[model samples]
Target: MKGTIHKCLAALVKEEYGEDAWKKCLQSSGFEPERNFALTEDIEEENSINLIVESAKVLDIPLKKLFDQFGVYWCCTYAPKHYSFWYVGMKDAKAFIIKLDEIHGLVGKHFNNAKPPRFLYHWTDKNQKVLKVEYQSNRKLIDLYISLVNGLAIYFKEEIEINKISEHEVELTFDY
Candidate 1:
């Protein structure tokens, strides 16, 4: 996992739940409250999961809700501000979703031991309005991925209907 994830999670927590709540989450997760994760640093997967789990407990929110909130915040707020170059000329959610694998590949090259999730795209309808996205990753963060897709819909002002095909696949029907 990249420290950028941790940094974004921290930012989301602090902004929505206040500094004290974030500190409590950190301490409960067995981390120093003042610990700062560098954007390019590689964070241990266990630590990342622990932080998220602890944050949900500390914030009194369900794990799914936390993931949902974080996904939206990352897509619409954090990433746009910090990685604006990635969004250059992106006209819609579909374009951005299709470019995810390429973007991850490019981003992985800049980090040490980066293993970002990869996406496989398939157009399921003749009209090209339906998409089936296969998420290939060992981490199995499918719920987060789904929420991120929802966030992309919000970001592009598009309505989407998502159906989970399996643990690793989702079929998206776009209403454009």
Candidate 2:
């Protein structure tokens, strides 16, 4: 599932931002843009999104500002049996939730077969910040995950699903 989401995000960004432009954006935003496991430059799965999110928390910056620093914007489509994009901004969790609800309605109305709802957002836990969201469906749940990666460019952050005790329930912890 993770690999598929990675591929989908790659494809979409290539289509939207161009490969070279996207790579430059990632680099300028302080991501390695390469595969390495043990450094902040590397985005190994466990450390990938959470690392960036934590940086944002420390610096008191919004994800969108980070992406803006890199000169990028994005758009994607949800297709048959597959939802294609997710994005996160730093401020106003409420507005973001409204947008997600609007997306859910749009996709549900268009597809005629509503999949389960998936959410992505930041929250505070015990005076510490965590970013998270969830989606469940037949396809790989790529939309939210890809949005998460893109969100990292903006949020400069990382997040993880700390618990998934059932098919329908997920608990995530973010580090930004």
Candidate 3:
């Protein structure tokens, strides 16, 4: 995982919970307990997962909630700092999501070992308002993917209902 993700997560935790909590989670993950991490640095994936899990336990929230919330924060806040090009002229959630694979490809161009997931978007119903996402990744952070879908809806100012049909698929029905 990118250290920038960890950095943004730390900032989010400090903003929502407290500085002490962030430090504690860092320590629990065998990190240096630094409040700020370099954006270009890379850390072991297991450490990042450990940090999230430990943070959830300390915050008394479900692990899924933490993952979902982090996804929102990452998309709405963190990515803007490093990849604002992807957000430019994005007028809708579906359009934003459809570009994910391309965006990850772009990221991989700059960042080695990007290892971003593959997202296939298809319409489950002919109405076109219903969208299904096929998420495939070794990390398998499905909750984050689900929350990212919801967060994009919020970003595009759309009211949408999301249903997680399984570990690898999500169905979304946009009310707009």
Best by lDDT: 1
Candidate 1 per-residue lDDT, tens place, 1-176, comes to 88888899999999999999999999999889899888888778898889998899999999999999998999999999989998999999988999999988887787778899999999977888999999999988988999998889899989989899998999999875
- The candidate maximizing TM-score is 1
lDDT of 3: 0.80
Selected candidate, larger lDDT, 1 vs 2: 1
- Candidate RMSDs in Å, in order, are 0.9, 13.4, 1.7
Per-prediction tally of clashes:
0, 18, 0
* lDDT value, candidate 1, whole model: 0.91
lDDT for model 2 comes to 0.42
lDDT by residue (tens digit), candidate 2, 8-76: 334444565467654554464565666223211213353434434443343456754533332223222
Model 3 Cα lDDT, one tens digit per residue, 58-124: 7889987887778778777778767788788987887787888788677678888767778888987
TM-score of each: 0.97, 0.31, 0.90
Task: Name the TM-score of candidate 2.
Answer: 0.31
Stretches of candidate 3 above 4 Å error? Answer: none
